[model samples]
Target: MDLVGNLYLPEDFDANKKYKAIVGASPFPQVKEQVLGTYGPEMAKRGFVFLAFDYLGMGDSPALAGEFKQSRYMFRLIENTWDAVSYLGTLPYVEEIYGLGVCQGGSIIASAAVTDHRIKKLATVSGMMAADPFQWTDKDVAHQMIAAANISAQKIYETGEPDYVAPFGLNDDQSKEEFVSAAAYPAMAGESYDYYGRDGFRGPKAVENFSNMHIGDQAMQSLFSLCEHYADKIVQPTLVVYGQDAPTAICSTAFIDRLTNDPEVSAFGGFSHVDFYYKPEAVEKSADTVAAFFNK
Candidate 1:
C-alpha cells in the first residue's frame, strides 16, 4: 500500500547494518510534512529512520469525504499509523521500532503501543489524558461536538458531500478573538499568526461539517476511554516529554505522570515538551534525552 506521508532514511542506512526506526505522528489538523519534516532529517542523521504522514482526511492523504464519523476516522488514522510502523519493521535495515507522537498523535501512539508488541519504545510530546479536551473549561463543547458529528454524518448520508468549516477559532483574518497563551493554543501550532509566512501551514478546518470535532470534552472522554481500556496493557519503555512554558505544559506533565504511574508502563521518563518541538536549546536537550532513551 502507498503510504500517505514522507519517510526519511538515515544517512548511514545500510541493509547489512540494521538500525532503529522512529515513527512520528503529527498532531490533529497538521500534515505529516510539517511536523515530521521539521525534525526527521535531524533524527535521521542520528541513525534513526523517521516516518511522518497525514491523517486520513487531512493533507495529501485520501480524504474520508463522507464515509465515517470523527470517532471512526480516528480509528482509521491509528490503523494507518500502525501500518506505517509495520512497513518500517519489515525493512531489512530496521533493527527495532519506536514511536513518538505530538498532541493527539501522542495519545494515538500510547494506544497503539499498548496493543502492538512490535513497538519497543514510546514517547509523547504534549500528550493529553483528560476526560475531555474542553473539560478544563466550563463550555458545553461536548454537546456541540456530538451534535455536529451527528449533523455532519446525516448531511453526508443525505448529500454524499462534505461541507468544511473552521474547526476552532475563526479564520485568521476573520476573527477578533485574542489568542491566549494556553496549552491548546500552542499545541495548535502556537497561534496562526506565526504560521502566516510558512509555505503550506494554514488555519484549522472541519471537513465534512465536522466543526465540533476537537471539542475538549469529547476529546477528553474519548482519550480516557482508551486509556482505561489500554493503559494497563502498555509494556513498552515510555517517555513523556512536555515544555514548562508551552501552553499545554501542565496538561502534558499531568499526562506523563499518569502514564508513569500506571502499572503497565515498565520504565518511563519525562522531558520538557516545548523544548523538543521549537526551541534550539530545548530541542537539543530533548534530542539527547530521546536518543539516550531509545539507544538504551
Candidate 2:
C-alpha cells in the first residue's frame, strides 16, 4: 500500500539485522510536526526505527473539502494507520511492531489494535475512550454537538464555502469565557476546537467541509460504539499515560479503569493514565513504563 507523510528509519538499519519498531500517531488536526517530530527522533536514537504520518485530512495529505468527510476520515485514520504497520512489517529489520498514540490519536490506535492483530503492544498518551467527551452525560452537551453539526452542514449546503470559525475549543474570545477551555493548551493553542463551541483552529476548507458534511454524527457514533465493541478485544500488553494537570486526565483515568477492570483484558499490565501527557515527571515515568513494556 502507498504510505503518506514521513517514515524515519534508524541509522543502523540493515536487512541482515532485525530491530523492534515503533509507530507514532499524533492528535487530530495536529501534524506529525507537533508531537512525533519531537518524540520520534528521540525513540530512533534509542535504537528503534520510528514512523510518523499525517492523517488523510490534516497536514501534507490530500485536503478534506473535496474527497473526504469527517466520518470517513475517522475510518481512514484506522485504515491508514494499519497500512503503516503493514509497511513496517515488510522491512527487513523489523521484528516486532509497537503503537504509540497521543490524545485522539490514542483512541484511534486503540480502536485499530482491537481489530488488527498485527499490533503486538500498545501505549496511549492522554487517550479518551469514554462514551463521549467528558461532559456528554448532560443532555445540553449532546444537543450542542447535534446542533453544531446541523448548523455547519446547513451552512455548507447553502454556500460553496465554509465560514471557517476557529475549530472547537480555542475561539478568539476564549479569554472572555468563565473558565479556561481544554483547548487552551499551548500545543493546541493555534489548532484545536470544541465540537460544540467555536474556539479552536480550523482551516477555511475544513470549516466549509464540516458544515457541508454528515460525517460528524457518524464519527461520534463510531467513538461510542467502538468503546463497547473493541475494548474487550484489546489483549496486548498495554500502557496508558496522561497528565495530572491536563484537563482530560479524569476521562483518561476512567478509560484506563474500564480497560483494566475487565477479566478478559486485565491480564495486560496497566499504567496510571494521568501521568503520561504533559507533566514532566509523569512523561518520564510513562516513558520508562513504555520502554519496559515494549522491551518485554
Candidate 3:
C-alpha cells in the first residue's frame, strides 16, 4: 500500500539548495499526530525537512490485510519505510535521509536501517527490543499477558478470521481498570487521559477505533522476531533514548550491546514511557538529541 505522509519543509526551504531529511515513524496504534507531529515541526524549525506518516492499517494510511498473513504487516512496515526514503530521495533538494522512531516505530526503523542505506543516522525513543519486558521484571504478569495474547492469536488462526479485540478490553474488569488508570499522566491517574484516549494527543481517534487498535497476532510475533534478528545488523550511528522509570528501559542495554558501533544511550531519570510522548522536557530533550545526532 502507498502510505501517506506530511513533509515539514524548513522555514527557509529552497528547492535548489540541498538539505538533509528525516523520516519519522509513529508509535504503535498512533498516526502522525502523536510524537511524530510534535517532533516533525520541531525539527523543521531547526532547519531540516521531516516526514511523518501512518503505518499500514493505522492513522491515515491504507488498511492491512483483513486476515493475518503471518509476518506480512511487520515486513510491510520496513518496505513502506524504504518507500518513504525513496520518495524523499527523489526530491531535488534532499541530500541525506535519517530516521527516528519511538516505541514500536523505533524497532521498525532499526529493522529498516540495517539493510537500507538511505537511513544515514538512527534514533529510537523507548524502543521495545523484545516482546517480553526486557528481563523477568514482571515474569508472572508478563506470562499472563503473553498467554492471553497467544489465546487471542489461536482464536484468529482457528476461526480463519482476524480477531478484532480492543487493546483495552471489557472482558477483564480488573485488567481494564488498570489499563484505564495507566492511560493518564503519571500523577493524574484516573483523573486525566491526555496522551492516548478520548480528545488525546492522537487527535479524534480513540483507543476503541478499530483502525488504531486492531492487530493480527502473527503480526505481533513477527515484530518481536524482527527486532531480535536485526538488532545487531544496523551499522549506522545510533542514539538510544529511554526513561529510567519506564518498563521498556530494561531492554536498552540489550539493544545497545548488539549495535556494531558505539551507540549513544540517553536516560531520563524521572521520566516514564508516556513522558517521552508529550511531556515538554522529554520531547525537547529527545528532539534536540536527535537533531544534533543527525546534523553530525
Candidate 4:
C-alpha cells in the first residue's frame, strides 16, 4: 500500500553490488522510530542496509478501516511487511533480506517468515509468539481480554460494524489520575503514554496518521491467537533476545521450544520488556547478536 519507509543504507553503499539487507518492524503502536530507530542505524553501522517502515494504516502510510477477521488482519500485516521486503528486493544492491522485529513485531516477522523464503534469517526482541492466560499473575485480566474481544467480534458479526474500543485506554468515566494505580501494567501503560501520547517520546509520530490507540476487536483476537497455529513453520535460522525481567519473557519460551529450527535465545540482565527496545545496553547487545547472526 505504498507504505512509508526509511532505508538506512550502509556507509559508502555501492549500487552495483548485492548486500544483505534487514527489514525492521515496529512494535505495536510505534512507528519505525520507537524501536527500529534505536537499532536500525546501529545495524547499518555494522555494515548492512536497514529498512524500517510504517505498516499500512500507520505513520504516513495509507489508512484502512480497522476491522476484520483475525486471519485476514494478520494476512494484511504479513503482506504489508513483505511489501517492504519486496521493495528491498527491487533495489539492485539488496540481497538476502533478514527480519528484525520488536515485541509484537517479533511475532509478526516470525509469522511472515513461515513461508516467505525472502526472509533468510530472523531475530526478535521480547517477541510474543503465543499467549497463555494462566501465565499472568492476574489471570482474570487475561481472560477478560479474550472475552472482551470475542464479545466485540460477535457484535461485529451481528451488526456489521466495528467495535471501537481502546483495549488499554481508560474509559471515559475513569479518572486520568487512576491511570497508574488501576492499570494492568501500570508502568508499561505510563511509559506507553510517555512514548506515544501527546508531547511524549513519540508523540510526533502518534499525531501523524498513527491511530493505533484503538483496535478493532477482531484484530485484537487475531493478535491474541498469533503463532498458535504456525510458529513451528519458521525454518530459517533465528535468534530471540529476551529481557530476563520482562513480563512477556515467557511468551518466547514456547517459540524457542517449538521452533523446529534450533533458535538461539539470549537473555539480557536487568532489562524489562520495554528496556530491550529502549535501554542502551540491551539494545546494543541484541543488535550485536542480530548483526553477528545475519553476518553468519
Span of 10 residues, lowest total lDDT, candidate 2: 261-270
lDDT: worst 10-residue window of model 1: 206-215
lDDT (10s digit) by residue, model 3, range 1-296: 67778899999789999999999876665667667888888889889999997766665676656554212256777888989999999999999999988877887888889899889998988887544445345677556656767887888778877665445331212232465655534443322244654455443344332233454453344425366557677778899999887766766657777777788888888887778887889888888988888888
Better of 2 and 4 by lDDT: 4
Candidate 3 ranges beyond 4 A from true positions: 64-72, 130-162, 168-192, 203-212, 216-219, 222-225
Steric clashes per prediction:
15, 16, 0, 0
lDDT for 290 in candidate 3 is: 80
Candidate 1 segments exceeding 4 Å error: 64-72, 131-139, 170-192, 196-225, 260-276
TM-scores, all candidates, are 0.76, 0.72, 0.81, 0.83
Off by over 4 Å in 4: 65-72, 133-143, 150-163, 170-178, 204-212, 218-220
As for lDDT, the candidate ahead, 1 or 3, is: 3
Ranking by lDDT: 4, 3, 2, 1
Residues 167-259, candidate 4, lDDT per residue (tens digit)? 557432333346557777778777655555554544544345444444456345444545535777778999988887776777777677778
Superior by TM-score: candidate 1 or candidate 2: 1
What's the candidate order when arranged by decreasing TM-score?
A: 4, 3, 1, 2
**Candidate 3 clashes between residue pairs 3 or more apart in a chain or in different chains:** none
lDDT per model, in order?
0.59, 0.59, 0.71, 0.73
**Candidate 3 accuracy as TM-score:** 0.81
Cα lDDT tens digits for candidate 1, 149-267: 56755665677655444455434333323443423555444444333212213333322222223322223234343542455467788876666555455555555555543421211
The true-versus-predicted C-alpha distance at residue 154 of model 2, in Å, is: 3.4
